[model samples]
Target: MYKLQVVKELHSSEGKMILDVDISVQQGSFTSIVGKSGAGKTTILRMLAGLVKPDKGSIHSGEDIWFDSNTRKNKVPQERSIGFVFQDFALFPNMSVLENLKCVQSEKDEEQIKELLSLTGLTALSGFRPDALSGGQKQRLALARALVRKPKLLILDEPFSAIDQETRIRLQQEILKIHKAYNLTTILVSHDLTEVLRLSDYVIEIGNGKIVRQGNTDLFFSNEGKTDQFRMTGQVVDLICENEKCFAYVVVGTMLIKARVEDSMNTALGIGDLVVLSLNDFNPIIKKIKP
Candidate 1:
């Protein structure tokens, strides 16, 4: 199991901020960090990658120790054996797809690049440059480069944020495939609740630099963490039915939401009814906001 116990502070013009966090992940489990912007999600991941030094805390992966602020022991980023895929798809503009993979590895381990290419279905596009590939293909190359060394831990930060809807779905499936194949201890940083629900075995909900909730995804669906966030005062414009359940369209200002209408909904809603259609505790997370 991988465990993280950390307390860090950030100094800014706004004021001093403390990020007190504690979490654990079982081996081969997919864990997600979910929170609003500036909630310290990226900071935690950067700390694990050894890119950012924490004010105080320790990080342990099973029996191995990665960082101990008390002892002043910190591993170099390259020595940590961590695979990171940032949201920007940071592929090298100067290198071909295959060459990018080769740069991260030694000449003695050149054959591993071929394995990565095939795994991500990029073997045929090995000769292509970053600019020549599609968004999904470029994302795959970025991931392939990360896995070329077969790192023990994989961390992705808002990976789906840049891709189109169709590409995002395809990439999500590919990610699940790779994670299971390697049995990697994966950590995902994302704000999309649906992605967290679908991809993660455990979720850590951060609010104002602290963990507000932590548990299995199923438990979250049964009892939502914040019910008030689901309700929006709007007008019911349309009723959509699938599998005999109704999904009502609620229009608030310029925004529209497809809310699941429960049997107990008091207002009799029809087209253009000025009534609030409360959103369900959970809404399907798509890469893009759909109408």
Candidate 2:
């Protein structure tokens, strides 16, 4: 079991705030932490990963003291058995997909690395660099690299926030498969409420740098049911107006989709107007995306 009780002084969007969290996570279970912007969601994960220092408190995992303020005992990030995936992918721009994974391993395990590549569906792009891969591909590479450490705790900080909706959905499934295959205790930080309920066994809600609620995912969102609208931000690359109906071709990261324009004012779409594509029941429609 993993237990965390930490306090830290932080400067968030809400100004000076104290991050006080006391939480426990079960072994081999998936949990997600969610909160408003600047509520100290990422800070908690960073502290747990040893990337950020807590002002006080302790962190223990299975009788091991990862951090203790009173004793001044702290383990460096490498010492803690953790695999952290960041939203920005945090990949080496100069390295290929294979090299990124190998960089995290102190002792090379060729078979394990190959298996990770296959598991993440990156075998074909093993030789490609981060610049050559799509947003979704880079995120996959990031995840694979984290697993190279064979970590006991996996922390994800909004890892799918940068990807398109379609890729995000697929990657979510892939992550669950990875989590179960390794039997690792996983914790994810995401802003999407539906996503939290979909992937996590347990959900935690933080507000103003404190945990407001934490419980089983099903119970937390049982009354809400599924989400009605899914939105994707994309740039319009092509548009055609025929008989007062405008059809737009928008590019969302690596995916190109065609959408029917229907804005609030029924304005004509330009060739380069940024748009938001909303999907419900596989039918995607377009609207003006505000900056």
Candidate 3:
């Protein structure tokens, strides 16, 4: 398991933003930290990656202590066993796919590098430079490069947000595949709800300098975490029933969600009715919005 407890002051165009984070993640779990901009989501990842230092507190993964402000023990970014994938692919424009993978490797392991290229389906483009590859291909190369060292913790910061929807979905699947294949503990910071719901085993929502809502994916669906930030508020924009199963199209903010309405939902439930959706069970629960 990994635990991060840190406090830091950040300066932005608006003002000082204090980030107080205390979170634990189980080993091999795919965790997603989500929130609006400047919610301290990425900061937490940076701190974990040893890219940023905290004013106070510590970070631990398994038996290794990554940081400890009290002891003045801090691991440099290179010392921490972390694979960080950035929002931009961040590949070396001058390096070929093979060279990029080789640069991060602590030791030359030919088979491991070959495996990564194949795992990300970049074997064919192994000699191609970042500039020559398409966006999706570059993203895949970035993922491949991050895995070169076989880091125990994989941190992704909105790595797929730049691509088109279809490509994003495909890459999401690829990440999941790599996670399981390596038994890696993965952490992602993304604002896309569907991606979070689809990828995360645990979801943490940060806001107001603290965790606004958090739980394993299951808790978001149950009644226990209804107040969580993962809750969705929407109005039924359309309803259809066919073959004994009912479906409702709900407009949640700017996103449209389609739910398989259970039999419990009365037939009288129609268009324009307010509804609440929860993100536990990795399934969205459709319920009438309470007064």
Pairwise TM-score winner, candidates 2 and 3: 3
Q: Kindly report which residue stretches of model 1 are placed more than 4 angstroms away from their true locations once superposed.
A: 11-14, 225-291
Count clashing residue pairs per candidate: 0, 0, 3
Tell me the spans in candidate 2 whose CA falls farther than 4 Å from its real position.
Answer: 223-291
Candidate with best TM-score:
3
Model 2 residue 248 CA deviation (Å) reads 30
The per-residue C-alpha lDDT of model 3 at residue 123 equals 92
- Per-prediction TM-score to the true structure, in the order listed: 0.77, 0.77, 0.80
All candidates' lDDT scores? Answer: 0.77, 0.84, 0.84
Q: Give the per-residue lDDT digits (tens) of candidate 3, residues 1-291.
A: 999999999887678999998999999999998888987888899999998999999999878899999999999988887899998888899989999999989999999998998989999988888989888998998888888888899999999888987688789889999999999999999987667766788888888679987887545423232334568887775678889889986656435566789898857576556898887766677888754
Candidate 2's residue-wise lDDT over 1-291, tens digit each? 999999999986657999999989999999999888899999989888899989999999989999999999999999999999998889999999998988889788999999999999999999999999999999999999999999999999999888887788789889988998999999999986646655788988899888987788656654333324488886765566788876776656424566777654345566456788888788787887665
Of candidate 1, the 10-residue stretch with the lowest lDDT total is 282-291
Q: Compared to the true structure, candidate 2 yields what TM-score?
A: 0.77
Q: Candidate 1 lDDT, tens digit per residue, 17-79?
A: 798898888888999998878788999999999999888889887788889988898988897
Structure candidate 3, residue pairs in collision: 218-281, 220-280, 221-280
The 10-residue segment of model 3 with minimum total lDDT is: 220-229
Q: What is the lDDT of residue 67 in candidate 1?
A: 93
